[model samples]
Target: MADNIYVVGHKSPDTDSVTSAITYANLKNQLGMKDVVPAAAGEINNETKYVLEYFKIAPPVVLNDATDKKVILVDHNEVGQAVDNIMKADILEIIDHHKIGDIQTGKPIFFHNEPVGATGTIIASMYELNGVAISKEMAGLMMAAILSDTVLFKSPTCTDKDKATVEKLSKICGEDPQKFGMEMLKAKSDIKSKTAKDILFGDFKKFDFSGVKAGVGQIEVMDLADLAPKREEILAEMRKALESEKLDMIVLMLTDVIKEASDLLFVGTAAAKEGFEKAFGGKVTNNSIYKEKVLSRKKQVIPPLESAFKK
Candidate 1:
């Protein structure tokens, strides 16, 4: 293993990805590992930016590619979501909460895959396991990541461990979980200033299953009705994305945090529509489907779509 390592998260980085990478890197350094620097596979999202600025921590260096570098991945294991040139890098470790994708390595590596809501929760337990004290800033960042990934503990992906970790972390950070979580979510609610491309790709992920090239993007808002006016514009942009990316299917999930529901917009082949209808059991009118209690894309969206594709 190389002495100098880069800790990174997946593309279109979210709060959990950013914080988990930094926190894990810090933990490694505290345990006598050196030069385990944190990096981001893509641009940080608004919520992550808010958390980093609130804690007065600088964002990680942007790493577009990892050719011939030693790296540790957090928050994602999918090759499509990974840093460019990941196949050429020496992957030493992986700590992630999402589904494992088609990632391969030439040598054996340390892997920690958990079912927790956020990668930060797993990293928090690692701090205890390693006997490293969590600093106030680290606590705050981890808290932000947990709250963001779990949607204030409202998403179906949230586990008891996530809630417990956030309660303890909120105390260390000296912030009320509910109040601070709302503030953090509000920071990402404003989308008027973002371009169509930005809105679509802000939290996008691509998946390949059984020869199906699918992309799913999500944006959380306080109110789904607030986005009604821009529906056509957004769908048009999604269509353009599908064509440009050469995807078999593309889905954009407009999530209402308060309502705990998601309105899905899709554009793709006829088989894609059939697959969605079979999996979701609803008519996709005007290229959209309003699904109640559909929040976690990993749990609710991808699994069903994968099942549908197999048929």
Candidate 2:
């Protein structure tokens, strides 16, 4: 059960999702926004783990409530993850740097779901807007998240706004963005002690789209070479994940930062296949994307489905 006002990130969280939730929850509590708690639906990847360890922070509490009420959702706007518990509370506010989804919030509420590089960037802006002092730890988390999500600003998903926000936050954090980028990606890449199941479902969720069921997961890596190498492992695990969650369809987004295009992995039901095909005119071959682009569930994946589902 969540506290008075819980703070949760999106399913399959990235550095921005996890770190921003923690930092934002910390700030809200400091400002007397009582009963604030930071939680994540996914496990911390190696890169995010390093950032937390560097700041001596722990992972946010694990939460998988698909119907969250009166909570703040960071990094993602998919209805499945955000709505679990939405009726119980009210979805009071949303602060994200992702493309908007079917957000269910009370009227006259504050929502900041931008197409920026990182939720941390949006959080940074909030601190600046509210004249809240940015702690060094919070600044560091935001800086790292910005670098990771933007591919050091080489990502097609990045906008000039993302750079400006990161630059300002970096100055506050005293981190060299370029240096940190290399280090962070390297940390995320060398995954030696993890199982394929742990690796895949470590940060996973089941999405019930009214009647159509779908699942989405986020994977961040510095190199694309490992993707083909890990292809078989990913496929088998995704099949298991679909069965375990009992989802009608599951889409595994193998987003390679280096390659850009996400290798979209599809499993189960014809409806999802047709739904995704109508959204993106990409040829499907055992759930793989030929042209690799920066695959962001927030920016690319969820938006199309939102439009398609309405039809």
Candidate 3:
């Protein structure tokens, strides 16, 4: 077991993060890497839970710390978003679909980063590139990740490659992508049992933009009505979190998958507020703003905020 290597994804694990770790680990095993185990940085969210149940697979172990372990990262590369104490681990490989981040290593490792809709899309392709067969379970998980990340191919981040990969996985999994994707999305939309903090931090991520720290989270639902009444309650938690986390800003995106839009609720310092305003040309009313066609936090939200804050 000394050769055991854990495959893990970013904190506040979403479907893409959780499923990508699992599928990538499976790929590693099929390629004769026997000791590769999949792990999650936090509790699996509801949407991911549904996928695991549908696939009849157990969720990955929640591993917060990786000190003295051999690990491969998926879904994210930023140290701030990674598992705790990741810097202490012996980094072996990274398979991600996000921007290259500040994770430095003692030695060069296999780093694969693509600008695809989901990490699972890249991993699914890896299975083909390696001539390894993806099992039905693995294909289902990959399909779920792609659908979740791409918002059923409605997100601006979705590409031709992502669509093609989903088509391939759909056939392998023997599930209709449209029908199955709605079921998974409906699972994600069910947040009645979650507290305001739970809803806020479910998919949260932390970032540092030129020394200014900010936290951004997103929750995609079929309708915004379910969250309308809790808007004030959620904002209260965001305000508290902004203070407690010592963040310059906190932004939560309430995305309506059906509407293909997002409503942003934010709490921030003066500088952060200025940057936020500059990032998106809109008037902030009552700590919230409606943004049409803003479905992707990574491609649409973070880039402008990063650029706005850098100056």
Q: Work out the TM-score per prediction.
A: 0.97, 0.83, 0.98
Return the top candidate by TM-score: 3
Error of 3 at 224 (Å): 1.0
Candidate 3 structure quality by residue, lDDT tens digits, 1-311: 45789999999999999998889889989889889999999999999999999999999988878889899999999999999899999999999988889999999899999998999899998999999998999999999999999999999889999999999999999999999999999999998888899899999999999899999999988899999889999999999998898999999999999999999888998888888888988768889788999999999999999999885
Scored against the true structure, residue 98 in model 1 reaches a CA lDDT of 88
Q: Cα deviation of 41 in candidate 1 (Å)? A: 1.0
Residue-wise lDDT of candidate 1 within 106-180, one digit each (tens)? 888999999999999999999999889999999999999999999999999999999999998988999998999
Model 3: what TM-score?
A: 0.98
Cα-based RMSD of the predictions, in order?
1.5, 3.2, 0.9
After TM-score superposition, the amount by which residue 190's alpha carbon in candidate 2 deviates from its true location, in angstroms, is 2.7
C-alpha lDDT of residue 2 in model 1 = 43
Which residue pairs of candidate 1 clash?
none
Q: Which stretches of model 2 miss by more than 4 angstroms? A: 1-4, 63-70, 103-108, 202-211, 274-282, 304-310
